[model samples]
Target: MIIAAYNAQDTLVRAVNSALGQQVPVEVLIIDDASSDDTPRVAEGLTRLHDNVRLIVSAENGGPSVARNRGLAEAQGEWIAILDADDAFLPGRLQRMTGVARRHEADLVADNLLFFDWQAQAVAGRALRLADDHVQQVGAADFVGQCMTGRSPFDYGQLKPIFRRRFLHARGLRYPPHLRHGEDFAFVLDWLLAGARFMLMGEGLYLFTQRIGSISSDSSGQSRTILNLQAMRDHTLGLLARPRIRADRALAGLLSKRADAIRDQAIWNRAYPHLRARRPGALLMEMLRDRRSWPMLARHLVRRHRARMLAR
Candidate 1:
């Protein structure tokens, strides 16, 4: 298991313990990304306590992608699993996921997530509904289509996958370091495109923690988020331009739509400050500058209005 940690002193132990508590024997590699807090100290403690746990500290802070890539490079496991610093695995998660992987001959496997609200200290809900206890094969087109912006509250990209290490090493697969956000989606998209036999299980074994100031929820980092979205948009376009992607008509169409959606999101992020400040003139100017964002803005307004109406 590879965990990329940054300033995760408060929750690192819980996450590491969960991995160690698994029924099967597992090696945990914690990559500390130059944490400003005592995360490295905590990770060091874990390393000392558990012989199977190792700590790899980076000299500089390069975000999760860089840390995860470093862990991937040093990982010796046949199957590689990613665990977030603040999140954890439920009991038997690895054993069950690996079982499904071996039974289906899958290169990558992901299970449904159990959303945990940190503040509430309770389970919020399940990420996906498991209609039946069966594994589903995820096609490249289907995966890309589900990732469309505003398609759902839960993103398919959020699924943390356990991958066959040999398959990744053979294809030289690694997270895109340029993207602080959406890197998982990009990596998984690339994996699927590379002919990975991706399988999704209905079991919710991963605990996905929802923290108020987390990267995805924090609005103060809007500019950084916009840059990430732009990078993702460019990445999608690059994929669409590939001969293999273009040959798959369904996948190509979805990729094109995803690119447009990402562009719209970046534009919306740019305009959000004006909207929040209640500066109609500034918001109008921003909208006029990027007329392509109008459809997305309209959809947003409609959704808000419907939500308000339903509240009544």
Candidate 2:
């Protein structure tokens, strides 16, 4: 698979290292979005040391989606692995993930991730509930259900998931470049709509490195972010109009997934205020107004109940 980045000088080395260190011998293709840093230089130097790691420098910066598209074109592996430039992979990530792909004959394998809080600690996470992988006679609803939940114990942002290259090409699938926010989410939705069987791994093999000043979180470019969310929602809603959605097992999952995507937008644009630093009172009020916030609020209640259960 391909590891794509733009101006990711500080974390690029570790990202490349993780790809190279995969249990399966992988072609760790690195695409630099014409970074104005030492990323290209560093990649250049490493090419001599590692034959698996290949570096390509783009003439212009087309963003990660574009960079990823470029890498997808050049990847030779039947399965493609994606790692953001900033995220690092734990050892055995590729081995376990690829093994799943081979066993289930899955088109897409979305695995779990261990998130590092701002302090870089292993905090509480959620269950993935990913359905079993079935390739030949895959159920659309079951497949889409796993993908829409958005949290399959996996961090979708990480480049640790494996994609069947032949499946991807057959469907002519590619990420939406214009979306600065949930572009990956949108792409996955389209793939699921087209009957991509998703397999989830419970293990969190990827490390998500949250960086400050990222385009998605930059208050300075809030318009672009908002537009991206709107575009994703609109795109997903359009999928519902397609002839599919007839799968009995996945109807609920599809609706839930749509709601979850909206809720995600809410978390970034609305629910963010609930934090103490962002003015909890106003945030709580907004959450009260929006029904989408209830699931998150219910999660809090469930956690509190479990805590009480343990204490008693």
Among the numbered candidates, top TM-score falls to 1
lDDT of 1 at 92: 93
Poorest lDDT segment (10 consecutive residues) of candidate 1: 217-226
Candidate 2 lDDT over 1-312, as tens digits, reads 576766666667877887788778788888988888788888887788898889888999777678888898899987888887766788988887778777887788766654433233332232333333322323445444444433332324332457788888999999887665556766665676677877767666777643322212222211112235566566556566555554443564575576566556546456654642568788778887776665665554464454334323
lDDT on C-alpha atoms for all candidate structures:
0.82, 0.63
Residue pairs with colliding backbones in model 1 are none
lDDT of 1 by residue, 1-312 (tens): 999988888889999999998998899999988888899999999899999999999999898889899999999999999998888899999999999999999999999987665655555567676853768999888798788875444569889999999999999999998778888898998898889999999988998885332222223211112137777778888887889987888888988898888877887888867876789999999989988767767776775454334323
lDDT of 2: 0.63
What are the models' TM-scores?
Answer: 0.84, 0.72
